[model samples]
Target: MIAADSVTVYRGLEIGAAKPSAAERARVPHHLLDVADPAHAFTAGDFTRLARPLVEGLQAEGKVPILCGGSGFYLRALLRGMASGEENQVEAAAIKASLEARGAAEGFAGMYAELVRQDQGSVSTVHPNDHYRIVRALQAMALHGRPWSELNKEARATPPAFPGLRFFSLEVEKEELKEYSRWLSGDQVQLTIHLDKEAFISLSELRAIRSRTPGTKTFGGLIASLIELGMEEWSLSNRTATSLPKPQRDKNFSL
Candidate 1:
């Protein structure tokens, strides 16, 4: 709602989406949330396309663009720049609108069926609620005899334009961050934990302190220990605390 230097995709989504509440909506203007019906799916690339301009325009006006969302991948793509080829606003809008109307009339399932028949590639991963995208897939199939998914895949395969961009993850500590599981959706928590150490924490503990305390580091000591040991066993102190904690303890020692 309040489009500034960066765009804030609304928070507090319900029904499996984190959307901003009504009170929250009045507090600030938001751009994307409940933009798609629950049945519809929105892709990172699509979001990147819509948000990039919002971000750039905000900067152009000397406003700071903030891309805020639970969808870290979406935020990353927008900031890093998703490859959408060159923008053809007229064509893009028309294409998007036409697809929405057509999908509405044809019914989402029918459209998805047609998409699968024509472009299995897109159907495999595209969600049903994502009517806009399903329609787009069908449109691409009619035009190119291939799924629009191919372009998306190609885009992902290509590296981000602004490779130098630094993505900072707000980290939380293990024992401290253990409370997030309750408030966070399973997928959100899973995403936060994936490839990170906190994933090992019991869901109950994670639920207890998630909001109160964040993990000290994104990952856990286990992987770090493995990395340091490098396939050779070392005199690991108190395996859990011995590896890294000992050094910190030593640093803190001395009268």
Candidate 2:
């Protein structure tokens, strides 16, 4: 399993971040934990770059790699790859400084208005008070001659790193599940299961069953429940206790 978390990514933050205990780690091998120093800034891009290879390696070995954590942006970056451009850091910094100066002189409201003019779609995504992103978006528009939102849309159109991905969100409230469903609408997931609190299964038990079953098809009632929950593609099982077909090495697993 790989963690897509920011708080737990840093070293020496166990208690503060409420990381899994050592006993839990002993039960399942976890990756990307305690990888960065507290002083180092670990961005979503950095997490995606590091995790992609690890997930691929596990898949190559015919092992399912579960991704866990609460860092939505990092998870999105890992799943949908980032926009590619050769950044001119010096020019970007200059532009950022100029925008900051403009904000200081003309007021933040004016700078925000400029951002809205550049890409109205970004208004909902970015907080109105977020000066850093406001400057960065304007800088991107200045450098690329396109809005940051447009760049993001183009990046999302790129082929996904992992196809045939299934997402299972366990023990989520109905409201949160609805929100997650909306957020993941464009992901093209093969299946998305949202289990209620009553149906919650212990992670250790679930892992044990998966390890023992290998590719054993059909979780009888589980499949039924999924179907009832509006998954029409799932059909009744035909295969016996046989190994599941090994997924392509390039695919990723998430939970």
Candidate 3:
């Protein structure tokens, strides 16, 4: 398994990052953990450079590499290569710090608004709450003297490092799943659903209700509605499961 997480990428951040324990690593071979020093900033480009070869080597050995992490940008870079040009990491860091300072002084909303004005296309692709990517996009545009969206377009045109790759998104709520679905563009992407029988039944009922609703003609609209219903049911089930009272321990019992 490859740990493509940005937080886990740095050394000496195990406790705060909540990285897998030593025992867990011993049980399963893991890569890309503690590969960089905390002092050095790790970029998606750097991650792609390192992980691509490991993934290929694993594939040659007839092993499917499991990429486990929440670093979406890094994962995207691994799957689809980054744009040409060696991004000046030092300059990018300075720019990011400046932007962050401004965000702190003013507000992140203002920073995000400025980014939208600078690169509307790229801003649309990223979530509003994602401050890291927002600042990064602005930094890239400033350094390269081009739009982040254009760079991404160029990157997409380049042949992927791992061809015929499939993506399976595991989301707790369907709304989250639907948002991820937007990230899947080409035929190479596929959705894999794993749910309990009760959840599956709930999803089926939601689908039926969505089918009967008017103005749910478009595929996107239907998907959004079904996901909304599914999330409601999932949340209710989760609450019910967790709300159960824990069994009281015997007063005389001791560890």
Top TM-score prediction, candidate number = 3
| Candidate 3 C-alpha lDDT tens digits along 49-157 | 8998999999999999999887777886877666535777778779877876676588778777887788889765666776666767777888898988888788777
lDDT of 2 by residue, 1-255 (tens): 899876677665454355889999999999999887654346566788799999999999999999898776677778886543446767766786688678768877888888898789878766677665676678778888887788767777776678778887768799997887575454313222332331233322232122112121123245446557654333324233235676576556655
Q: Give the lDDT ranking, best first.
A: 3, 2, 1
| Highest lDDT scorer | 3
Once fitted onto the true fold, the runs of candidate 2 whose alpha carbons sit more than 4 angstroms away are 84-111, 129-139, 171-255
* Tens-digit lDDT track of model 1 for 1-255: 322111122222232223466788788766665343222334455676677676667667976544555555565456544434444555655666676666657778877777777656775557876654575566544554455677667667776554334444576787555566544434543554343433334333322112112331222333355456864544444464654634345675688
lDDT for each candidate structure: 0.50, 0.66, 0.69
lDDT of 2 at 46: 71
Residue range with the least summed lDDT across 10 consecutive positions in model 2: 208-217
- RMSD each, Å: 19.3, 23.3, 15.2
The 10 consecutive residues of candidate 1 with the worst lDDT sum are 4-13
Per-residue error for 160 in candidate 1, Å, reads: 1.9
Better candidate number, 2 or 3, judged by TM-score:
3
| Model 2 clashing residue pairs (backbone) | 215-244
How well does model 3 score by local distance difference test? 0.69
In angstroms, give how far residue 64 of model 3 lies from its true place: 3.7
